[model samples]
Target chain A: MSALRIALFLILFSFALANENPDAHVFPRPLVIEYPENIEPRFDDEVRLKCASWRFAGEANNLNPWKTIPEECAGYVKDYMTGKGYESDLLRASEEAGVYAQNVELGGDGKDVWVFDVDETLISNLPYYYEHGFGLEVFDSVEFDKWVEKGVAPAIKSSLKLYQDIKRLGFKAFLLTGRSDRHREVTVENLKNAGFQDWDKLVLRLPEDHVKSATTYKSEKRSQMVEEGFRIVGNSGDQWSDLLGSSMSQRSFKLPNPMYFIP
Target chain B: MSALRIALFLILFSFALANENPDAHVFPRPLVIEYPENIEPRFDDEVRLKCASWRFAGEANNLNPWKTIPEECAGYVKDYMTGKGYESDLLRASEEAGVYAQNVELGGDGKDVWVFDVDETLISNLPYYYEHGFGLEVFDSVEFDKWVEKGVAPAIKSSLKLYQDIKRLGFKAFLLTGRSDRHREVTVENLKNAGFQDWDKLVLRLPEDHVKSATTYKSEKRSQMVEEGFRIVGNSGDQWSDLLGSSMSQRSFKLPNPMYFIP
Candidate 1:
């Protein structure tokens, strides 16, 4: 075939593949409702018909300027962390595991500090994924840095507020994410932009090691916190590895992550 | 030996066994966390802290009373479902799975419907587990029914609100849960007590079939919905199996289940 004809053929093939699924990375399959009717009705209950998916074009597709994440979810995040008697679990676990700091109070020499994963654990990153249509690809620090620079992805507002509340309450905060250290400048900028003003430390996942098992890398970081003489009062992450096997942070605080996971 | 001495010996023996680890139901050892920080990160990401050992306890734990759950996790249940857009990956998955009902303009027959699971999907059940101190030995549906009946457990309030919104927009609602069919009367009462005035249907799992995958039984129930010409918009469940391979429901809506999972 002529060179021009071959080029035309390739273009046609690409278009066909794209057209096969119109929404691109966004899957628009209809939801199924299949709960059965009660043969023996009993209690009065509130049922919700919820949509499970949102339109996410990945980091590539999000064209909307970054803004605060939805308020409804923000309230939910804040309430989840601060509400229940979860501290007791930490206390009990700490006592059992001998991970508790000697001084019960926070900020006592910052000897023991709690480290958190920033993206899913501390803030919401789904907008970046959905808006940009970026999925399954290695995170581009350059693009990520740019995204944070734009201040498009908001900290899970509630989590940020809770972190602030925790800081005010005396717990020291350290952030550790799977994000490469190369993006440290932008990540720090984003956190400050999102309202996390007083973190005791911020630990980005060193590309060579921290990104391996997010849980293990995070757990190892706790040792650093411990070495600093701070007993990790608590460790929080959207993933379990962030808190697994930490001798100091007996209690682990987990936030909800519906978007990306390292499991 | 004297009877008194014998009784003392027995008591000591029992204490030793009981104290070995009260949570006999828990699987052996802990899940992997912070593995060398440099291993390939599991890209799936939503792995729970208790990912590896999900068992009988994990599946049924949600049925416990809300107050029994840890306090810090109170709002997690509610937050999981109501969170939408790019902030939540699970919700994003639900959307991508094509579970959310859309284009109301396309609706014609009132018969088209969807079925959903309760617990983590619609009702926030984390408080029950967290407050109860991860009582692995306790699996009390009656207590849960009472709690639900009492209406103290908060609805994934956002999801509840969304459900109301969906119903108002004109889609019939149905519920399918692993809750025993025997408790149907109490379940209905609980729904009403929880402020679900218009729950159209409820289906509970058979006690015998609840052992393996509850999704199998749920999928069986989808036949009934299909017979009614209902295009199941989406399925909502905390476990993967609940939404597995049902023709009636084109998509599955999965909510975050931090406390436990059946897989």
Candidate 2:
């Protein structure tokens, strides 16, 4: 019994020794940055910097240097749209309008409708600009507007898929973007190039205050959908801005975005 | 600079020598039993044994149990749901139903609606069953039913906070759990005791027809919402099961779960 106890003690001691940690490098804890105790006013330079980074920085790239869309993104876009129930528009005219239809029934009455957004929420020329490394320095409204005039930025593939899905479901998917009213022609043309068809209403952000919050634009669009007596079943976008105002809609969905924010 | 470089090199060498592991007492890597893979295909007895010795074993004290209606999860849930626009009775009913609602919108008509799920998606009773020495051995129908009848496994605080926020959102929230329909009463009672009031529905798993495919059940629920003319603005839960169905809805949100799964 005594020998057995010794053996057991030795075993436990050996186990402890085996489990003991040796001289090992320990990783440093990550540093946390705290906010300033007092708020500071923004300066002109800061405002320029912000606008430059968000909007106007990459203008030359906005004109499209890449001859073709990257295959991975294209494939992802096609699969995503197909998954969402988009049917291919074999007819060229239907495809140009960016219009597809979804069946909607509200209170025994059925009506046709469409939904859309603006800024990066609508047509994103950013990817082209980003690829070219343009616009990191200056905010050139002239260059940016010229790009919009060209209507060169393609619809984000996922958003396009969602657009096509809504159409497959039987309701017209409209083009509502935050691009100013002046850029409608270019924006519509851009959608056409991206394979969108039959977009009934291309609601642009009014330069005036017809709507309450331009930042909260989706809400304004929802009111329009209601006025048209269309049952808005699904709304999609990349930002909270698009869904913010649509408090009366049936549903709103957000697509994944790791690239940019609206504001 | 030269002296400093030499010093650094010497220090590194000393460290390496110190860690030479002369006794070679380096402990063996932990035995990783692939029990999760084993859970399927094996007989019940084998599953129980694997589950008994799984990572879920021997760490009950470190699990850090908490409660929601009892109060710890309020702040996080409130911030998240309120951010998503869940405002009044719908939010209230969600708390009552013991689920979270996110990205909700008021439909054109007064048809209030929300969506949820079962397992860790709604309530997390796994810790309790898994915490105590109670393995599948005590998972007999009578005892499990009794446990369900009690409904007080102590709410997970984060989930409760989300439930409360959803209740505050003003839409009627429903629970779409994967548990068998027979467990509905206990589930509902459990939610009520946790201080939630609006439980629009509890779509439990049917015994003979479990939702097997990835897309089937959620698609059905969303279809139900659509057919009923409920404009589901947002849906929330821990599992992919809850949000996937509302693919065409206005918004879909997900929360983290460290407890259970379906697939």
Candidate 3:
């Protein structure tokens, strides 16, 4: 083909691709189904009660109380994991955090720390959840551990951007996760592979460090960080347990998460 | 003066006025001082401790423990009362609420309600706080009651806009306040004077409805609203008590209020 004809053909192909999926750039395909069966009456009292139970009280017998997740439940997960709105929300939150972080006069004593959680926060496990029924089925630890070992979970783009922004703002980034010590090597590899770099410390639960709960364990770790003279200016997590409890950071940002309940 | 000369002079004067205060269109003169003296260490832990105490434990001896408010505390009040940022935040919140309220299929049983707190949510008491030292001094209930009786508090512009937006979207707006029942007549007068019209109900705490805490009082009122066959889709307040406890609406938006602590 002539050069002019080739150029015209390429332009036509690009237009066709754009028309095929206009929102591809803004909103990636949702990881979970838009609608799930059996979980009717979304956003009603029943769903709220179930969610509150799951949040406050752990799952019963390794199974969620409801037979199927509500449509809104699935929708919220999909929105946060793969929608434009969630991206905008995260960016706005990060922008606000950046403002706060910038305002604080750091002592430069290597004590200005910002805490971040791992799974579904920095690196998303949506690919795993998408395959396994999006929390409708019981959580299979062995399966999830294997998925984590793969070291290929994609970065939550907004959070990755925030991580880089805060790092530039001179915070000593600390990774605190509920993941067991057994997975530390893979977790580190995963984080590195998923574009996270040069975090000051990555703290995970030791094999013998049995704690009351994730909240208790995480809060204790944060308190230890404070005891070591670090000032936690910003903390971001998908779970309330990750943000709440004693030795709370100066400002805590809760990213959208409705997929699974973490005690 | 010659016509052209007079016109040029007027234009020059207007430009000067505009330069003197460019934010006068969206933001009125802030009710609180732009910088209040002695309110140093604005966003520090001291302010957070005091604010959290007042939020959870109410007041002691009618005094805030902090000798001076945090600058951020005062700034938040000023921003919400008269800042472009606050206006945009409220508009964004209202836009979200509009989407939710519009999507819900109300049963049309006169049951779809949106609860709104009175002070600092719908009609602002900035005019009162402007004169009363913005919680730097002990709260004088008698003085504030008199101010309420004046029936002249201006509407919070963003909230008023939201009120209208939700009303237009067909959710019955209910005014649920911590104000004592004695102020009902004046409160109604003030609301009307401030441009609020056709609200479904105005609920206040009666003398007989004595409760241990404001949370209990407000939560009970909300539960009562629910028992009346109203499904609350949106609830907004300047205080957490207005939105917490039982029978919460589907979604809650908190308007910024750092001037005074309300339990």
Candidate 4:
């Protein structure tokens, strides 16, 4: 076994010796501890540099339809998500959206809307993702549904602030998520308990739309909103699918989510 | 002077004391030394986290028409641009593009082409940018023109390899750049010297199209390419403008460029 694996074992043993939970999630899981086959272990900096590069490439939308974080980036993604990096990333995006919303000349007709993606945009999925190897493991929707139904996810603090900011600035909030209609109540309860309130619409996915890609489905829904004479001023999502294609908002905000990418 | 400024001064003085060039470019330029007028200097980790967040936001196309790196991120950008981060970023992007190109089914009609943006995409402008505060200062066209006239830019190594790889894979290369027609000869010479050769077409911006944004201009150029019956199998550029809009390629690859943004 690798030295890292041994260290993790000792760490877990220490926790167990104290009669504490030895669950993988109770301690930081050894996400991506193994060096990529090509790199020498001593070159730890190179691994991190590569991880940052992959994350940046992911943000540039180069890694479209990516299922999970690469094993190489698992540790980086975990640190980024759990540390100051993730918080500050969300803060910067929300701050930019706040500034954009402030400058937007909202039509007095209450037709202006700002679309917000539910998962990882307004709510923290860290609690769930934390248990799933920080995206080293492939996404499991069955498990995700159980997490969603729990309705215990906390607010992404930065986005909650943006949610209130845009609403106070007179733009209607529209929660558009990929969650199925079956989980609407729990998702709604999750959002409300997480400090979101008075959203104009919470549009969940219909069974008919399951076959459609997120970009296409979200675009079509936004097109429907446009047909109803509502103008989308700003849209925020962790996935580019929520923000790209025809009928996209005048300005789209992408919050960082290096963990998982939904096409 | 701030402590950082003094440290930079001492560093520069040391260079001069050894009869070395005191040119800001010879020594690393102090980019983004200020703490954004907000963050406490003791919290260096927060500053770095914010900088990384800003860079990621920039990659997501959040800061379009941005002129300069944030004052808080100058050091981060400089380090990122000059260090392993930039190299690894280019490597990842090129690697992805290579894999993408390898899998594309060629038309066998000799119509498959890969689009490449010139500056900072095919060639390294680090020589010029290093002297210009690593994009901490607003871009200067006049100074940039002088640098272009020198015809000394080097190849972005990873991209050069991808360029060769795609051409070898039976795709035509279309050098689509925002560089004006006046700089065509020098740019060609620079590209040739930088290890690019046998490209199918070198499309430069005409005087008439100077007022057009990079997105519109590149899109129109690409539209013309499509009109002429060349299939754009892949598009690669450091700018979103080079990758977005109508008539884009089947797969568009965005290289990391947080230094400067072209609208």
lDDT of each: 0.47, 0.43, 0.64, 0.79
* Model 4 CA lDDT for position B28: 21
Expressed as tens digits, the lDDT of each residue in A1-263 for candidate 1 is: 35753453344323322333322321111101122334333212111112112212111111122233332333232222232212222222223222232334654564546566787555545445543332334445576665554433445433554566566656777787777787788677666655578787887767677446765676677777677677666666654446544443545554433233353
Highest DockQ: give the candidate number.
4
Model 4 TM-score?
Answer: 0.83
DockQ (CA atoms), all models: 0.04, 0.01, 0.02, 0.51
TM value for model 2: 0.38
How many Å off is the CA of B261 in candidate 4?
1.4
Per-residue alpha-carbon lDDT of candidate 3 for residues B1-263, written as tens digits (9 for 90 to 100): 35754453344223323333322443334332354545544455544433432322121111222343444456444433454444444444454555566677877777889999999888767667777656555778899887787666666666776788888878899999888998888888778766789999998888866554677888888898888888988887766668667787777666555466665
Model 4 C-alpha lDDT per residue in residues B1-263, reported as the tens digit of each score: 35754564354334323332321232222222332434334336667877887888888877645788888888788777766677677878888999889988999999999999999898867767877888988888999998788676666777878999999999999999999999999898878876799999999999988999999999999999999999999999999899988898988898988888888
Best by lDDT: 4
Clashes of 1: 100
Q: Looking at candidate 2, what is the lDDT of residue A142?
A: 76
Per residue, candidate 3 scores C-alpha lDDT tens digits across A94-208 of 5555666777888777789999999877877776777766766678889998777765565666677779988997899999999998889988876776578999999998975
Q: Which ten-residue region of model 3 chain B has the weakest summed lDDT?
A: B55-64
lDDT of 4 by residue, A2-63 (tens): 57545643543343233333222322222223424353343367678778888888888787
lDDT of 2 by residue, A1-263 (tens): 65764453344223322322322111000001132425433334434323322111111011112233232233332222222211111111122223322323524344555456644444455433443322222344576676566554544443455566666656766666666777777666667765577666778778663344554665666686778777665555544456544444444443322233342
TM-score for each of the candidates: 0.36, 0.38, 0.47, 0.83
Worst 10 residues of 4 chain B by lDDT: B22-31
Better of 2 and 4 by DockQ: 4
Docking class of 3: incorrect
Interface RMSD of each: 12.9, 24.6, 17.0, 1.4
- On residues B1-263, what C-alpha lDDT tens digit does candidate 1 reach at each position? 45754453344223322333322311111111122424443322223222211211122221211223233332333233223311243334344333245543536678756576776666544445544334332457676665444333334433454466557767777897877777677666645544566867887877776775665677777877777677777566766556654453644455545445443
